[model samples]
Target: MTDVTTPGTPVSAAQLEREADITRRVLESFDGCADPRLRQVLQSLVRHLHAFVREVRLTEREWDTGIEFLTRTGHITDERRQEFILLSDVLGASMQTVAVNNEAYGDATEATVFGPFFVENSPEIAQGGDLSFGAAGQPCWVEGTVTDTAGKPVPGARIEVWEADEDGFYDTQYGDERVAARAHLFTDAEGRYRFWGLTPTPYPIPHDGPVGGLLEATGRSPMRASHLHFMVSAPALRTLVTHIFVSGDELLDSDSVFGVRESLVKDFHEQPPGTPAPDGRDLGDRSWSRVRFDIVLAPGGS
Candidate 1:
């Protein structure tokens, strides 16, 4: 028998066995890993990775290209930008992780991606206070209550909120020390909270880096639907990281990160100019928007 080969010839049985042996060897090498969980995860990862390589017959040049792509992804990441997370997001990995962590639990609010723009120690606002911080956008009144699955109020819950401005840029995108359009506030005794924030608006995920390139190459849009981000937590409730998207947003069906959930959409009622503000804050001749998002948290978590 001859080991003859052609440019597109099928892989020979002997060659397949050789590759399988390599995968087996790699798996066996982790037999002594002290952490059982780590070993299990790595072994499974190796199996899937090897299977993919074999199935695709990945070429050396292709592998080099992939390594270079990852290098570029890391180079562009910084304190303000997270290219890796963006990659996971566009590829649906982030959503998969979210789904696995957040299973159905009664009427608990569905969890979504914790986007890269969340800043720690955001300025705190009181109930009925303004979160806009003078950012540019139509004023919107946002009110909601924190409750458990049993419909009982969870008072004193810490709720963190943030969003992009009308122009689709978060405060961090400005490349300076400005914390506009984001804040944190605790719920009142009745587990009720309210604030004035910019009307949620559609925005593009940071698309000037490697993740953006991937989207362009794959013929996908980088624009996310308009949404307001929220992170709510209490003593004995699951910390919920989610978003409330605006109803009637065309991009809702095509959100770049696949973060839109049908249950998360809420109507942002339009308030015509001269409509009296709910909190007595003057809007002058400017039309505003308002929305209510009663959040139900699943019981049991730190």
Candidate 2:
């Protein structure tokens, strides 16, 4: 009988390959688990992640740095701030996702990212109430109607509106007392609604996290054009989350989130000073900026 001798602790190229194969096999074990959708998602993620590591020939130092960056991103988040959303904004992921899901349904209003600054449960204000909270900037009157695709008014739709101040900062960023710029309004029987607010001005997104680092590395500015954010919904129609951008904003072409759509841009015309108040409220000599937009909603099951 012949006896074969093996090293006391063998660590050959073949052994290394076997170890790597075992690790991959253990991870891939979940590929056939229950819930086909979960399996599909996880499998795809694993495949792509592994491919990325190989494609980039990623080093341990790079991986550690990435983990640290993500940790810091979480560290900077709070009730009024979200560094992760800012990261997605700088990467254009938010806009890309919105555009992908906002396909036209017979001229329905275009949808845009909701952004990270929206505060739930804003004060409800009657139509024509000044949303400006007395802040000074371009005087703008925003009026619009919620309508079905057939041009019929869809009354009783809820419209939640918010926008940056004249200087392009949100009320939350300023203080709770500045909540005047945010309001919720429901359309009347005529499907019409209006509000008074300052024309939005281009403002920079928060630039103090990983997102800021990315923007700086890419030579891209963090400014978003002046615009009003809207979230509108009706019982039988698709909810629309969008923005109305002031035409001719200097940063329109370079919006940090890539959210500027040509169709969403409208001119803010200056109404004559000393104009009579249609609602009989005392509006002083301030020049009012006016813009009118109509929303078309998709029919049920659309």
Cα lDDT tens digits, model 2, 207-298, are: 86777887898898988888889999898788898999988788888888988899899888867778865666566876667888888777
TM-scores for all predictions: 0.96, 0.86
TM-score winner among the candidates? 1
State the C-alpha lDDT per candidate. Answer: 0.93, 0.81
Task: Please give the RMSD to the true structure for each candidate, in Å.
Answer: 2.5, 7.2
Give the deviation of candidate 2 from the true structure as CA RMSD. Answer: 7.2
The local lDDT score (0 to 100) that residue 220 gets in candidate 2 is 88
Scored by lDDT, model 1 comes in at 0.93
- lDDT score, candidate 2, position 136: 57
lDDT of 1 by residue, 201-279 (tens): 8888999998888899999999999999999999989999999999999999999999999999999999999999999
**Weakest lDDT window of 10 consecutive positions for candidate 2:** 1-10
Off by over 4 Å in 1: 1-9
